[model samples]
Target: MDWKSFMEGSKDLSVFALALRAVILYIALIIATRMMGHRQVGILSGHNYLVAAGIVSLAAIRMLNPESSLTSGIVIVFVYAFVNVLLSYLDIKWPKAIDRKPTILMKGGMFLRENMLDCHVTLDNLLGQLRLKGAPNLSEIDSIVLEPYGKISVIKKPEALPLTRKQMNLPPKMVALPTILIYDGKIDEMNLHQMGLDHEWLITRLREKGIMNLKDVFLAMLEANGTVYVSV
Candidate 1:
């Protein structure tokens, strides 16, 4: 047995060259993952998962095939990820055309058998999902919606609903939603503009909080209650 051939393993590629290929392909995969965005890290829908699998497979080719070009492998993976990004954008722009809509399996205490059959959901599937969601008795359920992402959303009947401030005759307090004005010391000009604010106004507000330099702020948040929270 040739010592060098045995040392290089099956591909006949040198250990250093193989390691280099692995590192380059790994970096390409990271770039493709980022191009696909953070949503890919979460519970992926069918198409999203397919794209992610395809990317990994493409990257693997570069590692296994000694003759394959690293640049070509990177390009193929990037193109696949870009297609997913494009489809996601189109899905947002034309949801009905690009993606499936949520289907109502149960409504008004009645199970829609036809709808369930069309979605290929069996009685056990519905019951299991309801159990997982901690739903009350089937009779107390007002609606069971199958979301496009394959998750079930349950709505309970008004009688079975939990008590809230409105039911107790208590006045509702204002809720302030926080919006980021600056992230990582960079001002979100679009958000600032949407809030009807300008650079001068933001600078003045920051000054009031004893923050003289924008770069010193790691985050700046604006609440609906007219409060500005800054973090250094």
Candidate 2:
């Protein structure tokens, strides 16, 4: 099967040289990303995603083509990053030019079909997002906004909203964020200490639930109400 030829490319550069190039390119990408500021990876806008994809494609080409000059690839990567930074600044100054406005797909339980079509969203797609958001029927939603980043934002109708404590004149209760004691059968000691708990206390709670070993538990969460939820 010519395994040796497949493992080592016909290129003149050694494996170590390729490895060194990859390390340098990785560091360059990290520095470029840091200069771009803190933007959530999951919520990158269309322009940001395109710029990132371009940088990746350039890096991949340089990695695959050993004859290609690394300096050229690095320069191109920096140029793309600089362009992204400039566009980001323009987006903040003139949002309308750099960013598309959110489209209102539905208003007052009525589908704005024109807006939906303009946003390239179909009825089935909108309905699927609505179902995911727990709004099965149009009557339950006051509006549906298609965000610029390609996410659906749903607003439930006032009449369909769940009752709050203010509606029933109930006293407000302090709610604390849940702390993860164990995840994937591994204990988070820092989280345990933050909650003023220790391994011995955790074992006692586990024993109360008839669980003797931590390895058997897949997840353990302590909620704001002092409720310990364990899953095996």
Candidate 3:
């Protein structure tokens, strides 16, 4: 076997070269994304999706074709990002012209067949979405609107909705998001600091659960109720 050649990679494109290209492309993508802003990664509009698709295609071309220069890929990625930003601005200014309006699929338990057909949504597809959204029967739903981004928004009928704690005169309780203390044997010191904790507290908690070494922990989370959940 040609083990030396296998380890070194092909003459045209070495493994090291590929790795370097990947890292550079990854960093370039991150910079491009940041320039485009957070909206690019959110529920994508039509133009946003197009820009994302173009970026992916350009990156793939650069990775597959070693003859293609990384500088060219980076330039194209930025170009696409800027174009998306421009389109997003235009969408905000002239929404009716640049963006499609949400279509009402159903209202008052009645399906709008014309709107459904216009949106290219089949009856089965609508039913499946409704089922997924926890509305088994049409009577349970007040309305269903199809967003521009192909997501279905269901509004349950007020009379058909379940009773909430507010309806029963129950007081609300403060809820905090769970913080990860450790993951995959690595301590998240930043998260600990954010939660106003330190290493000493985590060590004491672990030792109480008979876990001496941090490396032995698979996962450790600090719950909202001041509870430490540890998994080995």
Against the true structure, what is every candidate's RMSD? 7.4, 5.5, 6.1
lDDT of each: 0.84, 0.83, 0.86
* Number of clashes recorded per candidate: 0, 0, 0
lDDT of 3 by residue, 1-232 (tens): 3333332334476667776777888899999999989888986989989999999988887776666777767888888988988999999999889988899999988889999889999999988988888888887888999998878999988999888888989987559998999999999989999988999999999999999989999999999889999999
What is candidate 1's lDDT per residue for 1-232, written digit by digit as tens? 4444332334566767777777978987888888889767774666787898887777777787776667677778888898888888888799888778899999898999999999999998789999999994898899999988889999999998889999899999668689999999999999999888999999999999999999999999998788999999
In candidate 2, position 184 carries an lDDT of: 85
lDDT of 2: 0.83
Backbone clashes, candidate 3: 0
| Alpha-carbon lDDT of model 3 | 0.86
Best prediction by TM-score? 3
Q: List the residue pairs that clash in candidate 2.
A: none
TM-score of each: 0.64, 0.74, 0.75
Ranked by lDDT, the better of candidates 2 and 3 is: 3
The CA lDDT at 64 in model 1 is 79
Worst 10 residues of 2 by lDDT: 1-10
lDDT of 2 at 151: 88
Tens digits of per-residue lDDT, candidate 2, 1-232, equal: 3334323333677777777777877888888887777652556777888988999898898788766767777787888889888888888899889988788988888889899878889888878988898888887888899988888999988888889998989999768998899998899999999889989999999999999978999999999989899999
